[model samples]
Target: MIDGSPLVPHIWFNQSVHFRKGSIMVLKTLQASRVLVVAYPGAADNEAYRKVIGNLEGRTVQEETCKTATQGEVLRMREKYEHSPPDLILGIGGGQVMDSAKMLRVLLENPGKSFANILEGPLAQRSIAYVAVPTTPSTGSEANGTAVIKGSDGVKVPYVTRLMVPDVAILDPSFLSTFSSDQIFTFMGDTFGHAYETMVSKLTNPLIQSIARSIIDLLKLASAELRQTPADARGLDKLMQAGYLGGLATGSVFVGVCHALAHSLEQQKGVAHSSAVLSLTPRCLSWHAETTKDPIYSHLLSEFESIGLQSRVSPDVLAGVDLLLLARQALADPAMKTSPIRMKEQEMMGLINWILKK
Candidate 1:
């Protein structure tokens, strides 16, 4: 629909915008008078949430903090909202809470459908105004079209579709001031994966390249500054923006071996999602570049070279072959089917070896 690209434009801004970057302005355009804000664990007790809620002048707000939600717990939440769902669903948290909100939204719109039925369809099932407010610099769930739920195997199975994209993303810089340096780095790697996959996607389109480039550039800038200095609001804001844009870009498109590899780690290796990306992202890029040799896979590789990737290839990268095996064992993501270039076991081993030797 958008020039043959799967991505949609998601408006964004935080403290870095000299002028209004349009996130709040877009919210005002929705013309909805009532809003129910569902927040993640620990948000309500924090003064930050209170301060933010206080600033909203006339909007009637009821704040509910979601404790760690289980599968059954989510179903109950949906049941409560079924007869009388809110006018708008505002999700405020990391992946888990955001994803739960997405499911609730879907189930509420299509009554009598089993949750399993809801999972099978593309996200465009119906129209519901959804606003996403991310408090962390990671996960990029704020703008993505997919909502991942933990499956029986404990792996995240993503619900994918065009309609799932958030109507608005509110990325207030003040929200992420509490993250440690490690969290910022892990999230930035995710932005890198988004850029890499979209650029090299078997389904790559010319239209999303500029947005892909922006993700790459933002990650590069964020990576350098965060590695050297302490994480601050400004750097955190840019990193989150980069990751947010990356998710928006790749949610329609998707990250390739890196994310698949990360998924594997998530299921089998017991790694955090952020760590999965950080540990394998660079290696995945190296392997994909060498294995696919895609002439069009341009942006991320160039950024890698610019950022001393040529000099700092690691043993884990050299071990990409092992990781790929895990990826196959761990993940069955759709992106794997459409990767611009695919990798076999031998090629993956070669990538890891190259990285380790470098």
Candidate 2:
């Protein structure tokens, strides 16, 4: 019901997003007595996360951390808390941990149903509140409702529903200070891809595009500031804001052909998600420019080049993979449907070949 009208395009936030310095104060506002905290290993040792625990000292708290966000892990977590579900599920990590938190929340609320069953059918409203505190600024999992969990077969399955959106998002930029310069770029590269795709997404309207543009601009400023002063608080704060806006925009309109191709590479070669995304995004931009013959696409590519991201993948990663099959898989993703250009199978294959070569 929030900005759900069909007449205009507006970014809808189903959660309350807080951009603040401390993470503990947000916990006081939640109406939860029992809390299950799913966090990254060693996260609870940090000051912010520790303060969160301190705030809820008298409340029941069970903390769990998993290395991978997979369906089996979620199912196991589900069984552990099935009889006594927590009133709030607090996710405290990067994308995978946050994703695990979302899946755990969903499965706990709906017992006796498989993940696939819930993904395929209508889901009931969630009773347990979900609060997300992102330890990393990359995925923007806090602002969004989609959880991409790897299945048993290793394919990343995306479960998209408004029901999965966190009830609150606590973005504390201090967590970003610990990231190395190289790590910062990797995360910012992911953010750039999100903003770039959202700007040109077929599902985008004026409102979404405006926010996307702001994200890109803020990233540019933050990148320069971080380069001059590593881990500058002001720079990281701006980056955090950009990350949140990137999530809001991409979560609304969804990513496009770049993500589609990146997903294919990740599936076939086990390339890291952000690495594949950074590697293929510029090539996707080039393809869009050539195919659409649009000046805006060309300009966007120039702006993206200014970000100075280095692709982390080696050339041999695609060695023996079938370009045609890869193209088909990339095209098959639902993300491709939101692309500005609808490429044919052959055309997509050509782009893949070009990407690997260049």
How many clashing pairs per prediction, in order?
5, 0
> By summed lDDT, which 10 consecutive residues of candidate 1 come out lowest?
12-21
Worst ten-residue run, lDDT, model 2? 1-10
Q: Where is model 2 more than 4 Å wrong at Cα?
A: 1-10, 45-47, 310-322
Model 1, TM vs. native:
0.78
Each model's Cα RMSD: 5.0, 2.6
The residue-level lDDT of candidate 1 at 15 comes to 19
Cα-lDDT of candidate 2: 0.80
Clashing pairs in 1: 202-340, 317-352, 318-352, 318-353, 319-352
How would you encode candidate 1's per-residue C-alpha lDDT over 113-203 as one tens digit per residue? 6556764534344556677777766666777667777654555666765455666677775666577765666566556667777766666
Give lDDT: candidate 1, residue 180. 70
TM-score between candidate 2 and the true structure:
0.91
